[model samples]
Target: MQTNMFKRLKRTTRTALGFACLLIGIVFILLPGPAVIFIPLGLALLSLEYDWAKVWLKKSQKYFRQAAVKADQALHWFGKKLRN
Candidate 1:
């Protein structure tokens, strides 16, 4: 019983901290600082306990990768056109 309570308390604390970080990150997005940085970090922490967060994390990663690829392609095209 004692051990179980301690485990439960620890889990709750982790969840609370993760949630707080997620909210703060969201707020920071509209205010200032590197919001993109915090969002992934929050998702990472929340992923530890929530399936929804895990799904979002994967989606965010995929989106960022796609954006990066597009940016690279655009840069290459721009450079080629400049050379021509």
Candidate 2:
């Protein structure tokens, strides 16, 4: 019973924190803060206990990585063109 109580507490805490982060992130979306960073972090935290969040986190990571790679490639190409 003690272990069960502890488990429930842990789960509840995690869920509360995750939702808090996500909600703050949403509010920040319209403000002048870092919503993009917070939202992903929230999802990442939630992903610890949720499969749907895991999938979303994976997709977000992949998209960001691809964008970074594309930006790098574009910069490299631009540099090459400038050199020529």
Candidate 3:
């Protein structure tokens, strides 16, 4: 019985965290903040509860990583040009 209670508590905590992440992601979308980061984080939290969310999180992570790489490359190119 105690074990069951602990399991229930853990589940509830995850649910709450997932919902909070989702809400934060939405807010970030409307505001001028880290929407890209928050949206992926929210999807990751939701992935704990749903398979579809897991897929979305994976894709989002990939896209974000690609964007980061591109941005880094652009910055490097800009720095080289500036030095020249």
Candidate 4:
């Protein structure tokens, strides 16, 4: 069926993107930019088929959560005004 063919294509594309993201993440780590950013993304993509990626995604999610919390705290502190 045509629909079946489309599904296969979609899966293939997902797998490819997952690998690409992982490679980009590694490259970013040595060069510049937020390397951690791509790790989660790569894991997310890989998680579609692999169990290991799920674990990695969980870890990456935690890191992002912590970073968000820190950013929120920093913003709140900066927003506070000195009161008499």
The candidate that wins on lDDT is 2
Please give the lDDT score for candidate 1.
0.85
User: Model 3, 1-84: lDDT tens per residue?
Assistant: 999999888878877787788778889879888888678777877787779889988898898899999999999999999999
The residue-by-residue lDDT of candidate 2 on 1-84, one tens digit each, is: 999999989988887888788888889989989877888888888998899989988897898789789999999999999999
lDDT value, residue 55 of candidate 3: 92
For residue 14, model 4's alpha carbon misses the true position, in angstroms, by 0.6
Candidate 3, which segments miss by more than 4 Å at Cα?
A: none
| Backbone collision tally, model 2 | 0
TM-score of every model versus the real structure: 0.71, 0.73, 0.76, 0.67
What is the per-residue lDDT of model 1 for residues 3-69, given as tens digits with 9 covering 90 to 100? 9999888778777877887788789978987667777787887898889999999998898789889
Regions of model 1 farther than 4 Å from truth:
71-84
Residue 78 error, candidate 2, Å: 8.5
Q: How close is candidate 2 to the true structure, as a TM-score?
A: 0.73
Give the range where candidate 1 is weakest over 10 consecutive residues by summed lDDT. Answer: 33-42
Cα misplacement distance, residue 22 of candidate 2 (Å): 1.4
The TM-score of candidate 3 is 0.76
Give the deviation of candidate 4 from the true structure as CA RMSD: 3.4
lDDT, model 3: 0.84
CA displacement after TM-score superposition, residue 51 of candidate 1 (Å): 1.1
lDDT of all predictions, in order shown? 0.85, 0.87, 0.84, 0.86
